[model samples]
Target: MTKELLKSTLAELSLAENSTSIIGIKRGIERETLRINNQGRLSSLPHPKKIGSALTHKYITTDFAESLLEFITPATDSAERTLNQLRDIQKYTQARLDNEVLWPMSMPCFIKNQNEIALAQYGSSNVGQMKTLYREGLKNRYGSMMQAIAGVHFNISFPKSFWNRLQVIKGDKTDSQSFISNGYLGLIRNFKRDLWLISYLFGASPALCSSFLEGKESRLPFEKLGKGSLYLPFGTALRLGDLGYTNSAQSALKVTYNSLEEYIIGLKRAISTDSDLYRTIETHSDGSLKQLNSNILQIENEFYSPIRPKRNALAGETPIDALTRDGIEYVEVRALDVNPFSDTGISLQQVYFLDVFLLYCLLNDSPEMDNEEQKISQKNLEQVVNFGRDPSLELIKKGASIPLRKWGEETFEQLALIANWLDTAHGTTHYKTAISELNLCIEDSDKTLSGQYMSALKNSGLDNGCFALELAKQYQVKTQEHQYLELSESDLNNESAHSFVKQKEIENSDEVTFDEFLTAYFK
Candidate 1:
């Protein structure tokens, strides 16, 4: 029945008028990396001035630490154009670093202590101070080492015309916003159910320097590599596993994705509720704020998830408010590991595959997920991240165990159909080619990124840090030699100069004290 429904949906969407709508799919990327010294230690220097102010820059900004740089690309319909923009942004930034290089992996290089990680600074503006305080709270809750782990985020949204056609095909009479929001919610539910496949195919973080553990206890049976690294022989992406960016405190929230209202209500309750565990932590120290608040979550962004339904919030508006008012404008996939093989951290072929996968999520049959089903999904993701390449691995499906390879093969067969439709829509073979290449990874675990990365590490007889450092140096050299593709050097220089001016304007416009600002924000 599910297969028939998917087939019918695709058939309806294949009409000439509806097929053209697929060409309008928009996408954007946000890639994060840490700046390291020549020796691969985390850089202690402040954000580079030549890269623009992290507070106001539109394209370049700091995420958690001052050394953790985030590069963003504007939404575009062309995958090639998006990758070009990302490459140009990275190239421009790399040329400006005096003696620092961008780390090429999802895991951190080396850290002597927590003191080595500094919260990102955004000048003297009230909003800037609040940004730093939020990071301070994250450090208190999860530790700074976890914040150093970086990844790539892919944001995508179908055109309004496609949604309109989908609504017509489904014979729905609801309002436009209601239909679109519900459609995206269904997509989120399906994505959550099947995202373990993503981990098994594209996950790249198999090992890490022991320094990242920071003496913390873990249950994974990690083996020692060289003298300072630890790894799981068949691990795909340890960054998404138990010791990575997970929040144990959030387990009680029981957030559901059945509807936009339910999702918003859950998040609202979390931000408004105070936590007994966080209450003991000091909010103020030495006449300076240590954190934004002692709530379970300082803001909606603090709630971690593999994917998010997003709408660009206006000034002074919270993310949930924006969603409640205008509904979801796009969905951001946050589960991707930074691809070590690509200079841009994500390849164009990966983007092509993602387009097909997300469309499949949108068009497929998705039912409401109960708490039991949610638990199963989480467990499946955990299993894949830890032992994905193990031949004996199995995943739980509807209370029945299925071999990992069997499930993956079935998923890919469906994805192949969607890829063909996309190819016909664009009059090109790129989507088919991408699916064909990735399908091999499903057949043979050794073809996956994690497998290749581990093989390279073993062949060189170098630890994770040493191997990543070598790649970082090579990437820096290549970036310097390459010319800009989508953006020019002059364009980036102007953006940097304008960002400085914008930062100054914001600093001068602050009229109230930060305490008053925080009160108004929460109110």
Candidate 2:
């Protein structure tokens, strides 16, 4: 029944009028990496001034920790161009680093303590202070070690023309924005249901430095490696597992994605409701702010999810407020680990596959997911993360157990159809090529990123940190040797100087005290 609906949708989309809509898909990336010194310890130095002020830089910024760099690309219609922009940003940043190199893996390098991870500073403006304070809240709630783990975020949106065509095909009469938002919600629901496939295929963090688990107790059976690392024999993305950036408290929130209004309401309730667990943590110490608030979430960004529906928020506008005002402008996929094998955090081939998979989500038949279904999806993802390469692993679909490989094969069969559609739209076979390459990973788990990474680690007989550091150094050299692809050195330098001026302008423009600013923001 579901397959028939998907086939019908595809037939409609393949019409000449709707074909251009597929080509109009827009995408951007936010790739995060931690800076480490020669010895593979997290850099304690402040964000590089030569790169630009973290508060005002358009392409480059810090995430959670001062040493963790986030490189963003402008939204473009071509995945190859987006990747080139990412590479240019990384190359520019690499040129500015005095001696630090970007860590190549999703899991962080050796860190003796949480104090070693410094909160990202954004200068003294009220807004900047609030940004830092939010991280402070995250630190108090989830610990800084988890924040140090880096990931690649893929932000994608269908063009307005595509939504219009889709709405017409479905014979929907809702307002344009309402129809578009509903379409994205359906896409999100399907993405959530099938995200485990992403974990299984692209997940790279099979092993991690043992230091990450310091002062924590875990129930997973992790095997020791070289006296300094721990790993699951068949783990895919440990970074997406419990030891990574997970919030146990939010599990009870049961946030649903059925509608824009309901999603916004749930998030607002989380931000406004006080948390008994967090209340005990001091909000201020020695007259300095320790965190933003003692709420279930300090802000909308604090709520963790593998994927999120997003709209670009205006100045002083919260994420939910932006969504409420304009609806979801894009969807952000945060399930991806930083690909250790790529010079950039992610590869173009991976982007191609994502394009097909997300389009599949949009075109596939997605029904409203109840709480039980949500739980099943979560369970499937967890199972894949922990034992994706294990042939015996099975997943639940509609209360029936199916072998993981069988389910993956079925998903690929549908995705290949979408890939062909995308190929025809773009007049190229890259999408189909991506589908064929990744299909092999589904058939043979040993071809997956986790399998390859684990095999390499075992062969090297080195700890996770040592192996990752070697790759980091190699990538740094390669990045430095390559000329800028989509941007020039002059362009980066001018942007850096302009960012400093912009930071000062923002600092000067502040009119209210910090407390007043917070009150106004919350209000």
Candidate 2 lDDT tens digits, 1-523: 7777878888898998888786678999999999999999999899988899999899999999999999999999878889888889999998888788999999999999989999999999988999999998888888899999999999999888888888899999999999888888899999999989999999999898888888576799899999789999989999888888788778878788899998988898899889999988874557766778888888889888899999999987778879999998999999999999999989989999998899889888788987679889989999999999998899998799999989988998998888888888889999999999999997788899999999888899899999999999999988878878787889889999999999999999999999999988888
Please give each candidate's TM-score: 0.99, 0.98
Q: Write the per-residue lDDT of candidate 1 for residues 405-446, one digit (tens) a residue.
A: 998888888888999999998899999999999999877898
The CA lDDT of each predicted structure is 0.91, 0.90
Clash pairs, candidate 2, are none
Give the CA lDDT, 0 to 100, for residue 56 in model 2: 89
